[model samples]
Target chain A: MPTEPLAKRPGGRSARVQAAVYQALTDLAGERDVTRLTIPAVAERAGVNPTTIYRRWGTLQALLAEVAVARGTDAPPSSSGDLRTDLEAYAVRTLADLTRPGGIAFFRAEVSPDIDERRSGLRECLQRATAGLDMVLEASRGRGETPPPAERLLDQIVAPLYFRVVFSVPDTDEAYARALVADLFSGTWHSAVELH
Target chain B: MPTEPLAKRPGGRSARVQAAVYQALTDLAGERDVTRLTIPAVAERAGVNPTTIYRRWGTLQALLAEVAVARGTDAPPSSSGDLRTDLEAYAVRTLADLTRPGGIAFFRAEVSPDIDERRSGLRECLQRATAGLDMVLEASRGRGETPPPAERLLDQIVAPLYFRVVFSVPDTDEAYARALVADLFSGTWHSAVELH
Candidate 1:
């Protein structure tokens, strides 16, 4: 049997429900497209009341959006001393993560504008997703290195990968990531303050 | 009366049905969350049989995916032959289009993985989206402008704006567009090819 997710959490009915629901979503998401996921199915798998999920999550998109948020951004590779190597590894890991079972569904589901207003947690989810990368920037800033501005980083590094992610075209391999870093380094981007 | 999309296309009962269905979807998508859109709702809106929609479009996602592709990439601004100004204008226009009523919905609908398997049309949609940018690249190549590699362009320019589009953060104004173009110009990305 697959490892049980809920068992790892603290003992409590509410906690159990969350663990089960998250686990069920994680498993089901891997096996099938997220569109096929319904609250009743999640309820059945989680052994919780469908009404509970309906009441808590309100909608399938809402439930799935939370599940995606719960998945969190797996931390990027442990940083080596070198910024370039670390950042490149970060980009590659991000691409690799998308191929993981629930990763694509999470992003694909998150991208929909329909869920935007309903899934109010989007900002939190993104903050969590970028938390790891932000740390890298913070570390560079601490070292007295002027890390690239967030806007420049978005344009040069994050956007290309996202564009590839959404389109599922053109490779986003190590070379691509390095090239992006190189492009940003080559240019004098707009001046930006360090992340506070 | 709502504007009809396929009015300019060739005529036929089948074509008329396609036009009506497409028009209905386009119109409905503007007012409501696409997740709430059901085939029956679309069928009633389009004045076509729901079964016909099921037979022809298969799933709501499948139908929506095509509608998105059908909505297509808007052509970029007319060029003034100055590469930097033209490209910046293109970027600004792309951002402006996203703010339009249905633009975000179409993209949100387009990115789902369920439809990825069905809509091989996604690639064509993207190609159409980039056709204008590609022309700029080709023109530069013709002018012996070394112009950064496609990967570089994707990372530095395309990715940044798209990041904003998906995340809906950090303004992507005309000023930002000009800055990105300026940054690219400042870089020694790739080797020597004179911009004519």
Candidate 2:
């Protein structure tokens, strides 16, 4: 396995240590459950001392949170103008990533612990990924193609795909994705406006 | 707090111990995070010896898994003649349970390392809940209110609510419940079939 350095920045020794520790975590996640991972083993994989990792992340949970956020940041954003096409693309991509050899394994490790900080990171990543759907809804509203309450449209459309992913299940198919988009565009979304 | 006894038979010593342990867990969840709860504390709360708890449940994680399964088994079946109404009722009830004072706290506690068995219990509970919805869809098909491929209806109607519950910040308003039902029943759902 190639242990590439994390981020190339002109920082001090501490930055280097942080990068090495995160790489070690990724390596461990690929191999086994994060719950079974230990600080000593992480240090050995990173080729650093355990003390350095402790000083940097303070706790194993903290380390995992950082790694999760870093991994999320690396994913590219979706910006297709068409709502149905964009969402279908997003769902397919997300499903592909989650079902990959180590993908669900990594998410299972991170999500099993409902730590507030980690949950916050996961939520943020989701919001970032789905932000485009919100934009599409707004544009559709401008065109009088759909109703207002952009958040509901986005939520109804995008939330289920992630739900399936988190539960380690099959991906939502293209037909289902298109159906969700049709639902969002239909006037029925207006009925739930009171809920918001 | 009223400590509801779990098992009715209460003949076997092990069954009694399990019931007591579950009750203790419910009480603890009412007060604090379940992840931080210790074996001695649980034993004290249940008025049993710590050794007895260890002997029966093996570990805090195992005890938690058993408790989760017990709690999950109580989820009501989806019923009421109308598919939309049945699903709305189910969603409202689930939301109430999930957001109740001790509900989310208990859920977060059960999420932890080496707890796949506990998570699986949750999935099983979800499957049961969804199965109830499936029955509704099947009935709808009998009336010619919906198309074939029961799984599609299941995915469209049920998946989003669960997605909101597990992924998004939950919104349990009656209006939201109504809208969810309306959206599913609208022509948009039928449109998917035509498109397919």
Candidate 3:
């Protein structure tokens, strides 16, 4: 069966431009290998000016990284009173975003020190990646628990979900998220804090 | 400074072929992106025949996957009776392997459903990826403690390490690995098992 070109509902003109560009980028990834992707082709498909893309993004890697940040993390953190549910929401959103059609490819490209030499706004993704964890950590503190260091929280909870997300290792689900968060809070949390 | 071509110490003929092929592959990845890699290009650089590559591996994806597995998994599991010590060794080795110059690129290329359509021998990497957790699980059973499911062990300990490895987010070290294993056994195991 022939595949259809990706199109989204019209929104603010700027949003529409970004969507068109990202959709075009992913569509090209579908037609051929992403390593062959060029900004001209993306602009052609996106129906935006190639010069504008160069002015805005400067490089294909930067464009992909921006698309990834836009499509993958548009949702705000869920603030369920229960920490487990909130954490699970973050996991589900992250997994869904990254594992989506073009999500993993973009981030994979973003992290490659070689392919992405510009090294532009990528640190913002790092911060965004942990924003949810920061929320989860705050909740832990509110529960009167001495939360493990941000480093530990990231390693224990956020890292695993992303590892699974990128590698397609374990199933990412609420159950999986809950089990991990619960384990962190169990006696492990206290001992881990002491280790720091 | 101009980069030098990747060369290896003289070895047996089989090792020579493997080294030549991997060096050619990474060199091409250096010259052009990996998605543009072809057996012909690899053959040209390696001074090996295209027919030989086709007969042996059948595709560029398989060849890259093999390179990743070979380069990345050369170290065997360190068997320390103490789970934390053992886990630390495993984590350190894994982070070192994947984050090395060519290692992450290979796996990132290896896992893509499109690039790796053959999906041949990729599971070995997955198995090797989890081998440490497997040993830890067995040790738990030996201690008469019901180990948390493989899923949990991965998410809690292994995932975080890989997450850091891939994204350069949280740092991976013996100290980080030890904290994770210690947390797993402290009191979380009992609760997680009961929940299961």
By the lDDT metric, which is better: model 1 or model 3?
1
Which model is ahead, 1 or 3, in terms of DockQ? 1
Q: What fraction of native interface contacts does model 3 preserve?
A: 0.49
Per-model lDDT: 0.67, 0.59, 0.65
Ranking of candidates on DockQ, top first: 1, 3, 2
- Candidate 1, B67-159: lDDT as tens digits: 775554435356576677767776676666665666666666666556456245457656665776777777766666666666556565666
Candidate 2 chain B lowest-lDDT run of ten:
B1-10
Tens digits of lDDT, candidate 3, A40-103: 9899999999997897677786677666666655676756777667666766676666666666
Clashing pairs in 3: none
Clashes of 3: 0
**Where is model 2 more than 4 Å wrong at Cα?**
A1-12, A78-80, A96-119, A130-150, A171-194, B1-15, B30-32, B59-61, B75-78, B101-123, B138-158, B166-170, B190-196
Which 10-residue span in candidate 3 chain B carries the lowest summed lDDT? B1-10
Q: Is candidate 1 or candidate 2 better by DockQ?
A: 1
Tell me, by TM-score, which candidate is best. Answer: 1
Query: Each prediction's DockQ?
Result: 0.45, 0.31, 0.33
List TM-score (chain A only) for every prediction: 0.75, 0.67, 0.73
lDDT computed for candidate 1: 0.67
Provide the TM-score for each candidate, comma-separated: 0.81, 0.75, 0.73
Q: What clash pairs does model 1 have?
A: A155-B160, A159-B159
iRMSD values, candidates in order:
3.8, 4.6, 4.3
Point to the candidate with the largest DockQ. Answer: 1
